[model samples]
Target chain A: MDIVLGQLFTGLSIGSILLLVALGLAIIYGSMGVINLAHGEFVMLGAYSTWLLQSAFGLPFLACLVLVFFMVAFAGWVVERGVVRFLYYRPLDTILATWGIGIILQQAVRLSAGAELRYVQTPEALAGSIDLLGIAIPSYRLFILAVTAGLLLLTWFLVQHTEFGMKLRAVTQNREMASCYGINSSRVFSLTFAFGSGLAGLAGALVAPIKSVAPDMGTNFVVDAFMVVVVGGVGSLLGTVASSGILGGSTAGLAFLLNDTLAKALVFLAVVVLIRFRPRGLFVDRVRR
Target chain B: MSRIKSPSHAWPPANSSAPPAAARPSLPQRASYVQILVYLAFCLLILAVPLVIDDAFLLNKYARYLALGLAAAALSLSWGYSGILNLGQGVSFGLGAYAIAMHLKLKTSPVHTGAAGLPDFMVWNNVQTLPWFWEPFHSTLFAILAGMLLPVIVASLLGWFMFRARIVGVYVAIITLAMLVVTNLLFIDQQRYTGGFNGLTDLAWLEIGGVEFDPYSPTFYYLTAGCLSVCLLLGLALTRSKAGLILRAIRNDVDRVRFFGYDVAAYQILAFAVSAGMAGVAGMLYAMVLEFASPTFMGVPLSLSMVIWAAVGGRGSLLGATIGAILVNFMQGSLSETFLDTWQLILGALFILVVLFLPNGLASLIDMAGERLGRAPPRARTEEPAAAAPRAMGTFNTKQRG
Candidate 1:
């Protein structure tokens, strides 16, 4: 019973990180239909930024998080304006172009960072573990869970309630209609892409303490993020949240049962089967224009 | 080239809404004199390479490049000609390589008095009896046959599942990518049989009818070049066929092709299978030249590199794709050796630039020149969406389900 609870908590924590990564992916893909294969690189940038800020400036982890978000968001914004904006309609081209961008980012980091794994120090306040119901949960993980939930709620409120969110949603659903109503669809795409990138950056910063920060670390996250987004369904935020939970929980549970490689294979196989049955994913939005 | 009748009588108009083919001007039937000259020049250059480079190691390296070029051309057949962007092509290639590697490994294993020979890795793992899967590979003919068949069979299954379910475009790319990842993991995990991360190595020289095809020998280079030439010609023949026209039509509009009474799924599967079979043959040639097979053969990076090769060479043309693979890989080899630290960055930047600006690839330049010099109006290449970017954005937003 104790072991199960501990694993569940671990799953939730991991799922929360996936949610952060997938939310940005879902939003960018939903709004622009540009599959950003460079998203994992955005996360990698965030982690590297966090490490740089912590080591160079001695900034607090929370402060570094905010800085990394903006930094990576700015980088994403540049990528959008310079490269992705030109390829928005060409989904396949966008994929290839962004993959190229990803390779560039990874190689750039490898060159500058000497291809060595870097670590970020967890905040002093959240360095220890706490006991709950006879199961010990690491304080950092609990902190991450709380932060993820807070970010999710904040994003929901922003997208669901704010005027900019309304514009973003309108443009995503009907670009022509939204443009007719004086909404700048291009701006919406740019902002949405930047916001999504910022979210990925935040996830990277949060995960830095636990996972080693390396040039290629983002590759793993991007694959998982893609699985989460695909299984969650495109153009659905709620689906992203729900699918992340299912995927993350199952991954943790299976990892505990089988080895890591087998567990990953099983999860991938399951996702493939799910996709075979439900091409649109677990949730199908019925919103009519 | 003249075997197929004039397009006006032999084929329907490409666009369903357009005027009947009989009313429009007839399409050109054969490559222009300039195009033929260019092809001959390329062939001559390839033939003259060994004479110019003399060093056996360098000759071997060029042979390896040509083998990869053949694999890249196979990718072009499916991705460029058929519009099925299969990202898991290395899965087929690697399977073929491993099939041949297994046969080589089994042959070199010291035969026991009472049992079939066991691979060293299997013996190391305390595997008592040779696994059932490895038994048939002991026969060279069976191993070679299996190498060609396995990739085609796997591609058929994958293509059937994807096309039948109407899962295509980016979805096909994602699914194929996932499939390759899964296969790589499986290969790595079954270390006892596959030799784990350190892939099968120390292969003996492949012997054919009492003659050794040693890697250092020119015979091996000739072997690769022969395979490459055959595969390239095969790809060219298919792309120029009436069936290739139908495949291009399917790419342009799947619904229209179905309306035209063609089974789009069948065409897609056929293209995919043929491409896989070619990749398999390339894999066998690669293993023979390199003397080993590794999980890296099916890795995501190599798979993506194949896509880049096709894209660079002008995915629209078979010869172009083959050239693109050779050029990029040759550059990669030389550049990486010269500047190991910055070569990947340069390659990545080059890829992005190619996709962004040179959408038609390096071949388009030749085509443009041919048009100017041949004094013929630019002929429309296959059904590729010429100016796909801006128009695509509009359609994407308009077609959004929500």
Candidate 2:
């Protein structure tokens, strides 16, 4: 039972990272009608940015995190303006184009960093383990939980209770209607894409301390994120959170019992089955059309 | 002739293709019989090159290209004709290749030195005997059947779900990519059976009917060429059929085809199954040719590159896919061997260029130029034949395929 409880906490920690990645994907897909295969690249860039700031500039962790997000978010805006704006009507082309950009970015990173795995040090505040009852839990894992929860709150506030959030949601639901009402959908699109990419970047910075910081690190995370999006329901951020918990927890719990790769496969199969049964996912807005 | 003289001269300006429309004398609606014969002869010559090349290395290397060509043709059949963009074809290829890899690996096991045995990889992973899954693959006939049927069945199921949900565009692409990743992880983790990251390797020659089936032998080359021709013929025949034309129409406008009383889902699923089966056949040949199968075969990059080859060859032209795959493979092989670590950058740049500049693909360049030179007014001679007409660049402007 103690081992079970330990595995449960581990699941929550893994779920925290997945929540960050999948929320970014969900918001972007909602706003831009793009399944950005390169979204992972943003996360990757964030990690690299964090590494550069800390290692080269000798910045503190909090300052480095902020810089990484801003840097990658700016890159995301440029990508939206340059490559993705031409592809709104052709979603599949956008998928391919972003995939191309991802390959290029990954290769560029590989060239710069070499293929070897790099490491990022967590701050002294978040280091070491915490004893809970009879089980010893990692403090960093608990810190991730706090950070993820805080961000989820921040994301919800920005999307639901703010004027800019209203405009973004209005445009997503009906671009023509929103535009007719004097909202600039294109600007909204760019902002949302950038915001989503920035969030992904933040995820990378946060995860690099724990996970291996490598050029292709996004490849592993993106698969899990895609599964989260599909199982949660594309364009539904709330469902994304719910699905990530389900998938992430189950996957981590299984990994404790089985191999990590096997657990990943099992999660994927479960999601495929879930999507098969509930095409719109467990929670979706009721549509009159 | 009078109708042609006025309209053909005046057409490129209004159409806005900005292409070779201004260069050539207008081709007759009916191609001369000799032109057809010449093309057939050119194709014959291409076949003979593989045959007459005395160097076994060159002959067999191109045989591998022929395998990819077959896979590309399969992609065009589903994605180009049916408008399905079935991204899981590589998954099927990997599935088939893995099947044969398992068979070959099992056949050569040291455990089999004294008795019928499991694969060496399986044994290395601590299996004393063949696993339940390995049972059917032990027989050559059953392994082939499993290889072909497994992909078709899996694709059929996937197609049923996706088409039924009316998922199109990026959604289907995501679903398929999801499948590819899931399947790869499953295979990689089932290390007891699949051999994990090291994959199934060190494959031996296939033997049948008391004949030694050396992978490098000319007999395999002939067999590969025969299979390529057969797959190509089947793809062409399907495209030329009434069903193929309907599939193409669905690609253009799904709603209009639905209005025509066709079951759009059925056509798409059928096409997906057919294409998946073709990929499986190519995968089988690839396993035989390369004597190896690994997870990379089904990687997302590979799945995307197959689409790249089809697009670069001009998806509308069936013959172009064969040429595209072979040419692309040749360039990839030569460039990678020469440039080593830098080929990916070039390949990515090439992919981007093809999408942006020649959306109709390289094969369409000749067609565009021929029409412009043959039919355009003499006043347009100063214009480049390929770029004289205005270009169409949008999803709505997706060019027709053969």
Candidate 3:
């Protein structure tokens, strides 16, 4: 019972991070039909933003997080306007183009940060451990879960309940119909794209404290996030959440019992098997293939 | 050269809805055995490059390219003709590499010192004994067999699931990319057995029963060249067979194939398996030449470069893919060595040029010139055109689906 509880906690903490990463992916891919292969790179940028504010300006980490969100969000907006907007209609092309953009971004970061991992200190308030019932768990993991949950609620409220949320949902369902109804889809796409990217940036900032910030570090996460996207299902939020839970818990939990390679292979085999049955994802949709 | 087969056939089509367009030209029936000999002669002349370079380093470089050429040919079999765009083919190649690395690691490690147990990396990473998985790899014959069979089994299963489920395009690519990542990470984390990031090494020369041939000896070069030749022959036979045509049909029109009562996934799995086996052959050759195998052989950068090689060469043309692999690799080697700082910028610019302009690939350049040459003189018109890119003219024959 204790081991199971411990495993579940670890899984929950990991799943929270995946949620932040996949939220942006789901929004952009689901609504706009753009994969944004460079989404992981945006997270890297957010982490870098945190680093810059800390090292360059000597700002506090918590304060820097908020400022970096807006700053990174604005950067995302500009990128959407400049490049990604042109690619919304072409999914495969966008994947290739953004992959090119990712390489360029990685190289640029390498030039700027000198091709090595940088250390980031977690805030003092979030440091140390706390007793969760009878078991002791790291406060940082608990903090991440809290912050991510809060952000998720905030994002869900904004999307599901607000006027803009209605507008965004309207555009995603039927672009031509929404436009015929005078919904201004272009504005919605741009706004949602920027908005989703900001979430990625935030995820990056959160991850920075746990993992070292490096130019090439983003490459590793980029592919795993793709797995999360597939396991979850493209264009489905519920699908992503379910898969993230299954994947995170399974991978980490399996790693505890088995060698890491076999664990990963098992996850891959699971995805392969799931894909065989569902094809689209673990979720079903009317659109075949 | 044929004066616009139809006025409506022009690209971007003067208009979008142009009556579905006409079929492209049929396969040219001009290659006699005489022309075939000339083509072979040209390829052989190019193969004679090592005689002139005379530098052991340079000969080895070309030899390595030849080995890579075999891998590229296998890749083209699946991606170019089959249109599966299997982005995780590198995983199959890596499986072969790891197999050889295991045998070599066990053979040369100082701790084990004998060729019968776990590698030193496994020992250092605190593996108490040889894992059960390592048991199958103890025999040289079984190790090689498993290397090939593992990828085949995995690919077939993956293909059966994916194709049967109708996963196509970006979704398929994304799933495969995820596979690559998960595989690489798994390799990295299994520090105890797989050597993690550092990977397995310290392999000595290989010999088979009373043969004292050193791995890096001239005999090895001939061996690799011979292996490449055998792979090429196998590829040619596969591509020329009825099954190959069916594979191409599946690529161009899976819906049509299903409509005609064909099991598309079966063919797909077969092509993927053949390619996987070829990759294994390439791996065996690579291990023999380098005398060491590491995770780097199956790394993402290496895998991506092969994709670029196949694409830039003209995925449709086997010769073009081989040429692309050699040329791009050679250019990268020389450019990185000479420019150091600006090589990436140069490569990026090259990628853009290739994507935007030569989208059909470098092989298309020859065709473009050949078309121009068709009008040059009466003398040139009689000289047959080289197979520029294997144009599956039947692909657009939508009626065949009936």
lDDT (C-alpha) at residue A117 in model 1: 91
TM-score of 2: 0.88
Candidate 3 C-alpha error for residue A96, in Å: 3.0
Model 3's CAPRI class? incorrect
Q: Proportion of native contacts in model 1?
A: 0.39
lDDT string for model 1 (B1-402, tens) is 001011222223334322245643433434534454555576667766766676888887888888898888899899877777788889999999999998888777465212446676777777779879988987888888989999999999988988888777777777888888888888988888898887788676677778887777677777777777767766666776788988877766677778989988999999999999999998988887898999999888888888888888887777788899999889877764548668888888888888888765788767656555654433332222233322322232222121
lDDT of 3 by residue, B309-332 (tens): 776787666667777887877876
Which sections of candidate 1 miss by over 4 Å? B1-27, B32-48, B109-117, B336-338, B378-402
Residue A119 of model 2, lDDT score: 80
lDDT of 3 by residue, A102-158 (tens): 666666676777767887788898798998767889898898888887887887788
Top of the candidates by DockQ: 1
Q: In model 2, where do residues sit more than 4 Å from their true spots?
A: A286-289, B1-46, B109-116, B132-139, B208-213, B336-338, B375-402
Q: Estimate the TM-score of every prediction.
A: 0.92, 0.88, 0.83
Candidate 2 accuracy as lDDT: 0.75
User: How high is the lDDT of residue B197 in model 1?
Assistant: 83
